[model samples]
Every structure is written in structure tokens, then in C-alpha cells.
Target: MPVLQRIVKPKTHKGKRAIVNREPKLIEDLKDTLCIKGSTASQYVNNAMRDLYDLKKPSAALLQKKNIILPFEDITPIENFSRKHNAPLFMFVSNNKKRPHNLIMGRTYEHTLLDMIEFGVENYVSLKEFKTDKISTGLKPMLVFNGELFDTNHEYGRIRNLFVDMFHREVVDNVRLQGLEHVLSFTAFENKIYLRSYKVSMKKSGTKTPRVELVEIGPRMDLVVRRTKLASDDLFKQATRKPKELKVKKKKNISTDNLGSTHGRIHLGVQNINSIQTRKMKGLKKTMAERKEERKRKLPQNNDTDNSKKAKNN
Candidate 1:
């Protein structure tokens, strides 16, 4: 029997995986606005989508302690909590009667305490003031940042902003360090704030070819905050005290006669005195020589000599 032949059909090609609908006018408008070729529209959309996605997502490091706030009675418990959780701590002490409430955030309780002392907060209670249970249990909002977008703003943002300002003032402004791109990020753990600063540059990565990267231009500083009195004008005045006037020793006037034969040797060093004396002697000698020359020139033709000779002759 003559065998029957089976025909193999070719697979049909499916176009692009993603499909987006838009008005004809909108598509034309986007093309004109972007100033791109029709063929590159998909590529442009892909890039824009990627950027939008990135904006929507929070930083990985930042999200770890998103809504965590541990409370403690003493440094020992705070230290223990931070160590156990491996996160930083934040404490805000406010006096309703005063303005500029204290915003304290640090890696450790010890660091926070030191910072409080530095801020001149002598009378502060760690546990007595704050209800630790409320904070840890999420009964109340742990952090409240002052700005728009309350929903997006979190403890990390508040702490980052505070540290960035402080870092810029103390390190970039006071120390006058340059090429300080910005505070990359900060970690509060182990009772300290680890602030990382970077100098962003395009440099060669081993090979001749260069790539953009962040180079750490430290001090990866450890910051601390302590409990203190509420912020006030008096506190600011105390913090910014005027520099003490320098006590300059008054130089006693020394008499030239007291310097003896050296001629004011003590007042005007040996070299200076010698120069002065030489200059004076040179001037005196020049004047005396000029006077002697004048006398010699006048001796030949003098009215007094002529009168005396004429009188004698008469």
C-alpha cells in the first residue's frame, strides 16, 4: 500500500506579551512629547514603568524597622531590646509649655543618654515619662514626623532627616569637608547612630573603563541623644555662648636710656638697634660734611672778612 504522508504545520508567531490601550490622540501626543520614533514607544514606556515602580517601593534597609518602637525603663532594657531586635531606638520628650521638643534617636540607650546630656537635659526620666507598653504594643503612634504625606512618613524618614541636618551642620559646615554628597543612610543599633557619608564619583572599576559608584568619605560617625529639658531660648543661648575675650599681656614701655650703651637694645633687638645707629650716624656725617663744604665755599667770599680787612687797612 502507498503510505499516507503527514504535513507538519508551522507555529504562528504571537506579537508582544503586553498590551496597553490608549486613545489615538493620546498616543500621538505622547510620541510628540517624548520626541521619539514610533518604533521606540514601547522601550520608553518600559523605562518609565521601571522608574515608577522604583518610586513606589521603599528602600529595603528602611523598611526593616517600619513600625517598630521598643520602650524601656532604663538603659539596660533599651540596650537589651536593641540588641535583641537589632534595630535603632527613637525617643521624643516634649514639654507642652515649651517649644522645640527634644527629638532623640540613636542606636543605643547609652548613646541616647550621652546625647541628652550634651543637649543639657539633666532632669529626664526614661521610663517614668513614657508608657513603654503602649509604644511596643502599637496602641499609639510611635513616631510623628512634621511634614506632609503622613501616611508615607515613618520613623526612618524622621530620623534620617534629623541626622542629615545635624551631619551637614557639624561635619560639612563646621569641619568644612568637601565633596560630601550626602548622608547615604543611618543605622541606630548598639546604642549609637552609624552615619554613612559617600563621595559619588565616576571612577574606573579595576579596568580602564569607568563606572559611577559611591566612595565612602567618612566619618561613619556614631551619634547619640540624651533626655533633656524642652527646647527653649535660654537653652539655645547657653548652647551658643560667646567666646571669652583673650587676655593679651600688656607690654611695658622700656626707656631707651635704661638700655645703656646698646642704645635701646632690649626694645629694638641688636640688629635693629645697629641699623638705627648706622642710619643716624650716616645722616649726621652727611649733614656735617655738607656744612663743612658750605663753610669752605663761603670762607673765600665773606662780607664779615672783607669788612674786617677794609677796616684794618683804613
Candidate 2:
């Protein structure tokens, strides 16, 4: 069989396994995003994309002053860039008179545009405006969505899902309290959506649990719903279908709860516990034949006369 392209020989076993996991499989790997900016990108748009790029650094790529590609009209160029970088998610920022301070974000299915949403910036507050310290790089953020429309309206629901898919990095089983360093919040009201970022501050409390506070660290935006191009129902369904191997299988007799303890049931045949061999003192150790003979023999009656004499002398 012909070998695959761009496959490098890894020196270590760990490196080899890492490379193997990168291959296409039934369970898709985490998707990285590409943050792109055009020549017409303004100061506010530039700052927003820059901050987002830094925040998503561990799994995102940034391309600045690149091709003036707009997903609304022609997405081919954007798709090509994404394929080159191996990023399935992308955000394009531009500020022209026609669509001033516009942001287009989307995901790709097989390097083809799946869906795109365009938002016009009403107002923006960059991180530079806030004097708060920036969060640690590569720390996963907690995502929160506010407003009833996000849960009720179909389009709004899609938008909420897209933000989660794009901004959130790899999934994890558990997280530490200190590891939860930041939060990204989305609020929609009166036909406008507001995006906010905050730094989580842990304060001393008289009790065991510390008091928590949210300090706004910006790159905040007041966005107006401008345009949306969604995928067809059939295509979207196909894209979201999970393979059998990726589904969580129920363990045969195992269960767990909120606590760290594990619970399970084990079935076995009836056993003669007395016949089982166990540790013995050196003096008591004996061969199989001796053990059988000893078991057959009976012990003498108690020496009641000797015990009575010892008690009388005491």
C-alpha cells in the first residue's frame, strides 16, 4: 500500500502515538480555529481578534493582513487557508463602509463552509481599556449563556452552540478550582448580543469555601445581529452524527457517584473458604499429608487437675 503524505518518523514511543492519534478516525479530534484579519480591519476589530487569538492560543492560528476573503460572497479562499493550517473553525474580521466593524465566524465540514454568522459591532471594549491582569495562557474558560432567546429561538440556539464550539478548547474529565481562571459570557437582549469576559477572583472567607468574584476583563462587544447563512437540515444532521465507537458504553456491573468512591457487583461460584490455603507460622507449617492426618486426629481432654493445682498455689 502507498504511504500517507507528510508523515514523519517519530523518535520516541510517546511521539509516535501522538502522531498516530492525529490521523482521521471514527471519533473526530478537537478542532482548532483560525483568526483572520483583512487589510481593512480597523483598530477595534484588530484588537478584538488579537485578544481572542491570544486567549485561544493553545489550539488556534492567527493570520493577519491576509487575503481580503469574505465568507458572505466567496468562502473558497478562507477554506483554503483553513485547510493549509488544519483549522476547521474560522473567524474573519473586516471594517469597510458597507459592513463596518463586521465579524464573520463559521465552521467547515470537510474543508467546505458549513455555516457562517455575521455580526456588526455596535460598540467594543478592548482588554487594553481594562487595567486588570490578563489570564494565564491555555487555561480553559467556563462558558455561560444568558437570555431566553438563546434557549428558545432556533437561530439564537445555533449561535450559542457555535460560540461554544469555536471558543472552547479540548474537553476534560475534571477541573481544579484554581484552574478555572476565566469565563466567557454571552447575553442577548433587545435584538443585540453582548459578549463579556471576566477574571475569576478567589477571596478569603471565614468558612472553608472561598468567596468568588467576577472582575470584568475586556474585549467586550455589543453586537447587532446582521446576517446568518446556515447549513441545510440534511447536511447538518450528517455532520453531527456520532460514530458507534465514540458513544459512551455502559459498564456491565460498575457505577460511580458524585463522591470519589466506586461501586460494583461481582458474581462468582460458591467456595469452600476453609479449604483455601493461607499464611501459617513456621512451627505450624506442614505438608499436605501431615495436614490431612492432623485434621483426622482428636485433641486430649483439658487437664483440669493441673489447672486446679496452679490456681490453688496462686
Per-candidate alpha-carbon RMSD to the true structure:
27.8, 10.5
Candidate 1 per-residue lDDT over residues 230-290, each given as its tens digit: 2244543453344354344544653345547333224443465554545445545667778
Compared with the true structure, all predictions reach lDDT values of 0.33, 0.84
Where does candidate 2 clash, by residue pair?
Answer: none
Q: Compose the digit string of candidate 2's lDDT tens values, residues 233-299.
A: 8998988888888889999889898997789999999999999877577766788998787666633
Candidate 1 global TM-score? 0.23
* lDDT value, residue 114 of candidate 1: 22
Q: Candidate 2: where is the Cα deviation over 4 Å? A: 1-22, 250-314
TM-score of each: 0.23, 0.73
Q: What is the lDDT of residue 179 in candidate 1?
A: 35
- The segments of candidate 1 whose C-alpha lies over 4 angstroms from its true place after superposition are 1-197, 200-230, 242-292, 297-314
